[model samples]
Target: MKKIAITIIKFIGFFLGWAILSSILPLSSSENQAIWRLWAEIMPLLAIIAFTFIFWLIEKKNIKLHLFDNPVKGIALGAITGIVWLAFPVLIMYIAKIIDFDGTNSIDLFPVWVLAAFLNVIMQELLVRGYLYQMLKQKHNIVVAAAVTTALFTALHGGAFEAGVIPVLNVLTMSLLMTVVLEYSGSIIAPVIMHFLWNGIGALVLDGVSLADDYPNMLIATFTGNEILSGGICKMEGSMIVLFINVILTALFMFLKNKQGTK
Candidate 1:
C-alpha cells in the first residue's frame, strides 16, 4: 500500500512538473513560425526529459531507462509485431472496398514527424513501463502492476475519447500489449519500436488519408465513413478487426514468452 501510494504521488508529480514546464517553456514563439514548428516536433522529448528528472528525484532506484536485454532481437520482433498490427486493418479496409488509394506524394514534414514519433515512444516507454511498472512491481504482483500501468496509460489518452469508445478501448488494449512486451523482453526497446512503428504508419497512412485536404503531399486513401468498421478519426487502430487482432496477438506473445522462460 505504501509503495503504491508513493508511486501514485510520483506519477502525479511527474505530470504536474510536465504541465508547469509546458506552460513556462520558451520553446514556442507566436511571432516565429519556424521556431513554433521546431518546438512542435520536439515538445514531447523536452517534456520527457523534465519528467525523467522529476521522477528521478522522487524515486531514484526504480527508474530503468535502459533499452532492453537484446536490443536487436527486441527491435526485430517489435517491427514484425507493428507491421502485422498496422497492415492487418489496412488490408481489411482495402479489401472491403472501403479504402480507395489516391496515390502518393512526399511530406516535407515527414522527417520531423518521424523524429517526434521516435522520441514520443522513448518518452512513453520510459515513463509508463520503465518507471511506473517497476515501481508497482516492487510491491505488487506483475498482474497488478501491469493493470495499474495500463489504466494510467489509457487515462492519458482520455482526449482521444472524443473519437469514440472503440478508439479509447483500443488504446487501453494496446497499452496492455505494450506492457507485456516490455515484461517479456526485459527492455523498453521492443515496445518503443513497436509503438513508433504503429504511430508512424498511422501518421503516414491514416492521417494521410484523413487529412488529404489539409496536407497536399500525402499518400491518401479514401475510406468509407463508418466509425465501427472503417474507423473515423482514429482510423485503423479504432476498428473492431484491429481490436480483435490486438487481443489475439497480445495473448500469443505472452504465451510464447512464458513458454520460453520456462525452458
Candidate 2:
C-alpha cells in the first residue's frame, strides 16, 4: 500500500506540473504550436525517465530497464490495443447522442494534426501506462493496479474540462481498455503506437477536431451522403458501430485472458 501511495503521489505531481506548463504554453496558436508541442513531447519523457529511475532505485527491480525487450511485439500489441481501445469514444459520440458534431472543414490541418495527435499518444502512453502503470502494478494485482492508473489517466485529460465528470469517466473507460491491451501485449510500445494512430486517425483525420475541446469533435464540414453515418463525429468515431465493436472486442479479450490464465 505504501508503494501504491507513492506511485499515486508521483502521478499526481507529474499531472499537476504538466497542467501548469500547458496553461502557460502557447499550444493553441499556429505559430508557436510546434514549440509547445515539442515541450509536451519532452516533458512526459523526462518525467518517465525520472520517475522510472526513482522506482528502480527504491524497488531494486528496475522493471523499466526491460521496457524494450521485444520491440516487434510491442509495436504489434500497440496496433491491436489501439483498434480495440478506440471503440468506446467512437460509441458515445455516435450512439448516445451525447454531443453534436458540427462540421468545420479542417482538411488543411490534416498533416500537422495527425503528427501532433500521434506524438501526444506516444508520450502519454509512455508516461501513464509504460512508466506509471508498471510502478503501480508492482504494488497491486492487475485489476486494481489498472483501475488506479486508468483513473489517473482520465483525470489528467479531463482535469482541463469544465464538465469534469463526463470527460473523466470517458477517459477512465478508455484507460481500462488501454490497460487490458498493455497487459495482454506484455509491453507499452504497442499501446503507445496505437494511441498515436487512434488519435491521429480517429480524433483528427476522421473527426477533424481536437480532443481537448469540451467535447471537441469533428465539425460536419459537408455532408455527402448517408446522413445517418456520413458527416460529423460518426465519420471520426463511426457511430453506434464503434460501441458494439468495442463491446465485442473487450469481451473477446477477456475471454482470451481467462483462457490463457487457465492454460
lDDT of 2 at 4: 59
Q: Model 2 segments beyond 4 Å from truth?
A: 1-36, 64-66, 80-112, 159-169, 213-243
RMSD of each: 3.2, 5.7
**Highest lDDT: which candidate?**
1
Give Cα-based local distance difference scores for all models: 0.70, 0.57
Best by TM-score: 1
The candidate 2 region of ten consecutive residues with least summed lDDT is: 231-240
Q: What tens-digit string does per-residue lDDT give for candidate 1 at 89-181?
A: 777778887667777766666665566556666767766787567766765678887888888788877765778888787888899899878
Model 2 C-alpha lDDT per residue in residues 1-263, reported as the tens digit of each score:
78757766766765566556545544333355544454555555555556556556766765553366568987877776666556554554456554445656534444555555666676677667765677667655666668777766766774424433333334455567666666666676666777676776565544532364422224552223342333233343333344344456556667776776899
**Colliding residue pairs in candidate 2:** 78-190, 78-191, 102-219, 102-220, 103-219, 103-220, 103-221, 104-219
TM-score, cand. 1 vs. native: 0.85
- TM-score of model 2 relative to the true fold? 0.67
